[model samples]
Target: MTPRADPLTVDVVDLIGTVVVRFHEEYEHAAAEHSLTGAQARLLSLLAVEPLPMRRLAQRLKCEPSNVTGIVDRLESRGLVERRPDPDDRRVKLAAPTAEGARTAERLRASLDFAREPLGQLTVAERTLLKQLLQRMLGITPEPSQNPEQEEKKGGKGEKKREQGE
Candidate 1:
């Protein structure tokens, strides 16, 4: 049987999935000693900032509120997070990290005990550039072309070459 050649284009969704999987693998490896699932550890980190409404957390995690309930239950079982009544609204439930959870976050961040170490190899300039590019790709900024003139200033040569199939 003859092999089919791969098309020149790559799907954006496939690229995103690949990156997510690679990041999760690295994160799991780094946090393996903590006896905490990656999702639990991530939730603990999120709660360390301030108590957040459970619904808001679920939105942030891009999961159903019920799914977050299970994630939070596991974290709560580990004493890494606590639930409290929202002061602003009695109907709302707030989630916050415990003191032990804060300590764990500090330990994890201070020990460089996560996938972030791979990013450390990049220089500050490279990191900044990567962040900017990713932000643009994610549509986080209204102005997608930070240097729009650069392409036009190339004097139409690029378009001509493309038209001629160079």
Candidate 2:
């Protein structure tokens, strides 16, 4: 049988901590280049893909909706983002990036050199494995995959616990 890994050590914890800290530092630096806070840049990045409800953004950012509102308000004033009614649910508003916001987000992403270089060196499969491992480490289950090999990699539970809010 394969031997189980030992429990996490302080050194390992510190290494992960350092990685998180450095990643944020890099992100914050990129955000500052665009005159945006890291949080604003993050929300803009998400919107660049697709508009999301404030509640959803708040959940993803692990912050209060009021905080998201304030950020969105500033972005809106700058003509970077616009609040639109969700067609599926009129009661909810979706925060979408304006054309300028999309470009800004793209630029901010491109400027994150620290992440870009190392991640670029990895193959697509290696990147996917890294993502899945990170998700599990952070208690965020990786999404269920169609490939049988991937399903086997899930090992259990992760596939069933896909819903973030739940």
Best by TM-score: 2
lDDT tens readout by residue for model 2, 1-166: 9775556766787878888899999999999999999999999999999999999999999999999999999999999999999999999899999999999999998899987677656544556787877888889966777333564365533433432324
> Any runs in candidate 1 off by more than 4 Å, and if so which?
1-19, 111-115, 142-166
Question: By TM-score, how accurate is candidate 2?
Answer: 0.75
CA lDDT scores, all candidates in order: 0.71, 0.85
Return the clash pairs for model 1, or none.
Answer: none
Best by lDDT: 2
Q: Write the per-residue lDDT of candidate 1 for residues 1-166, one digit (tens) a residue.
A: 9675455334655766887888777666545657777776677778887888888888887889898899888888888888999989988889988888888877765654334665555444444566678888887874454343443354433544444557
Local lDDT at 83 for model 1: 92
Q: Global CA lDDT of candidate 2, please?
A: 0.85
